[model samples]
Target: MSSTAEPAPAADPPSAPAPAPGRPSAPGFGQDRLWTVDEHLADILAAVHPLDPIELQLPDAQGCLLVEDVTVPAALPPFDNSSMDGYAVRTADVAGATEEFPAVLTVVGDVAAGSGSLPEVGPGTTARIMTGAPLPPGAEAVVPVEWTDGGTGGGAATAMSPAGPGDRGAGGEVRIHRPVEARAHVRARGSDVRAGDLALAAGTVLGPPQIGLLAAIGRGRVRVRPRPRVVVISTGSELVQPGEPLGAGQIYDSNSFALTAAARDAGAIAYRVGAVTDDADTLRSTIEDQLIRADLIVTTGGVSVGAYDVVKEALSSVGDEDEAGAGIDFRKLAMQPGRPQGFGSIGPEHIPLLALPGNPVSCYVSFELFVRPAIRALMGLKDIHRPVVRATLAADRTLSSPAGRRQFLRGAYDAEAGTVTPVGGAGSHLVAALAHADALIVVPEESSEVGPGTEVEVVLIG
Candidate 1:
């Protein structure tokens, strides 16, 4: 050895870092690039914003969120009306009236629903009013037609069969047998909702009942966040159409159908594209073609680091900053079945695309974990994910999972017992098991094994 180390021989040109023992030096297929589910979800959601509110007709606004507080422009009933097909008479006129001693009154006229010409009832005069027909000017009460012998002394009448003016009261005289109180069986103006009252709050979801209420308040069209249009694509060379015969190495494409239904269940209008082959150019071109109709894009498969993992290879250069849209990024998450994923924007409009694993179970789980929330966010919904509940394990054996990965095992939840039973094993290809599962039992990353009676979090998927 020279006197101290002959001037450190030019620090041997900084050799490149060595790859970890069994992991790739690059990001793909490597544990070093794994993302937590929450981390990936947060990133996907940060880029998503609610769609602009538009005035859509009542028929088109179903499942959409209301943007503004809808006020009742006019009273819900608009005017006093009869709630049943009966005689409209003054309460005092029919006092103590019964079948034995009936108060006979002259039939002024017949009132039908939406009739503009309403007769005024005065003193002993009465109007045969149909349900929803506006109350006559002087009427104070209404008695069912059954109580008055159906104006025919015949058997009980199911309805007032007088559809035309010619058939209006062939029975000239009407006898009011039973007595009625003031406003009896009458729908008063503003009884349901008054003018200027709130018909629906700003964030109300427009279901059938809500739409009916808005219509009752004269809201033919209202401002609402429109339903997102999701385009679902499945990429795999070994995939075939659902009805078509499969070859030796081919499988029917189920991810597209499953995810499309899932997206619709999450309140998006979903369109499914048949499986794209394992070619990068074909997948990229197909996505470009679908961009015009897509508010969000979801693709399953071709995201892993296999030789034919075309989603990464194809969409990696999908968007350029010089163009109008952005690029897609693939990521691996620290979760079972649904670890391989991708999410980003693409095309001129910069729509969001979520890439899930190709396996059927993994694809569906990924949808519930990620795509559903993204769709809800686009629809301006505050609650995004499926509600999770604490449930006890009903399994007889302890469940095992990988050390550092959060495991979501398919489960059948018994709501009454407040327990969840695992459906299948830890295999990601257990599609049949997934079909039987109504929920997912979430086992935390730190807890590798769970015994019976252990309380676990269950996410409702049904």
Candidate 2:
């Protein structure tokens, strides 16, 4: 009778789990925050600022974007030069010259490259000139060595003899077998670029050819966004060095090496901190040591919810201990193989840090999706992402993925066939498969399965 009277008691609502350190807890129950790929990319980009411009040598500035319009300081070539190693002559003298009845001219002298002495070509006279040699005065055109009778009245020759060509006897008298127009085989002063002309605009990427142009304009150094000094570290107690003998349950440390190389490929000056054991104080100390040298910091293996995730434990408190805004915010992204990520700034300098997953393949995928773009952005590059192409799936069977996760599978892309074939199964531990892959096949969050012949977006790594 008493139990029946007390049967109408009220119950309380279930509570949501508390958020992790440095992460803002969701407001409601059963609601976990999940970031889209674009959301995560935007957050990363917002944290990065382009490096300050510095004057670097031409070779050092290669692959870096120019921060200012590089005007031609001096006219390219600086003076008119001969484009061929032959005779510099007036067009009028060789107007009707031919092999049968060639125009004979007296050799005034030879003009080699970098020759300071000048030679005057009077009427009925020519100057034997080398390629890149400044054109002698009073010469209106040039006759290539091949067009003449080798200056020896013999058969055709492949090249003109180099150095003191005047001593070769052929330089004494040259037969003008072919007529040349005005300025023929002669590069005019500033023909390539004139003084005050814009040789390269601001934001131009300096490659081999661009560097050559700058050198031609007499620019030994240029102002450009400097390459980011990235520091990469790995943390795992069960990880062993590659050459060391492994104990039971030990795996070789690969994230450090892979991430360092990837950072370099992204145009950052990467410094490998190797692997640290599962110790929060050690990780904290190591990061402190690297703060002075790092423009960006990358850590692998410690941003998860596990009890022993030292990176999360160490860096979560950095904001409070050091200066303001010095902590990392760990995120759970709606993506496969690289869902757990941590990004933030640390120390007095507020250096950006990206903490990725522990799995070898997962780390690499994270690097391509986030680290690469961050590095390029730091170098003031306009295009940060890898080239994406639409390709047809080339699998024999349909490929399945997690329903709500955006999956990135390793693939071998056939550029000619315009198809992409998955390299391995959906396993994050397959390092070998990732190595064999040259592309990443992206499956959308809403698409759980993709069949052969289906069009997909592929990120070309090659």
> Judged by TM-score, which candidate is best?
1
lDDT for 2 (candidate 1): 4
Give the Cα-based TM-score of candidate 1 against the true structure: 0.90
Instruction: Give candidate 1 misplaced runs (Cα > 4 Å).
Output: 1-31, 152-159, 166-171, 321-325
For all predictions, the C-alpha RMSD in Å is 9.0, 7.9
Looking at model 2, how many pairs of residues clash?
Answer: 0
User: How many clashing residue pairs, candidate 1?
Assistant: 0
Give TM-scores for every candidate, taking all chains together and pairing residue i with residue i: 0.90, 0.88
- Per-residue alpha-carbon lDDT of candidate 1 for residues 1-462, written as tens digits (9 for 90 to 100): 000010111112323343333211222322245667876787778878899999999999999999999888888789999998888999989999987999888787788888887788898888888989999899998888888865644335554554486555534667778899999999999999998998899988999999999887777999999999999999888888888998997788878888888888899999999889988888888888888899999998877667777888788666443453366666667788677777777766677888888878778888999899989999999998898999999998999987667889999998999999999887777789999999999999788899999999999997
- Which residue pairs overlap in candidate 1's backbone? none
Q: Judged by lDDT, which candidate is best?
A: 2
Q: Residue 308: error of model 2 in Å?
A: 2.8
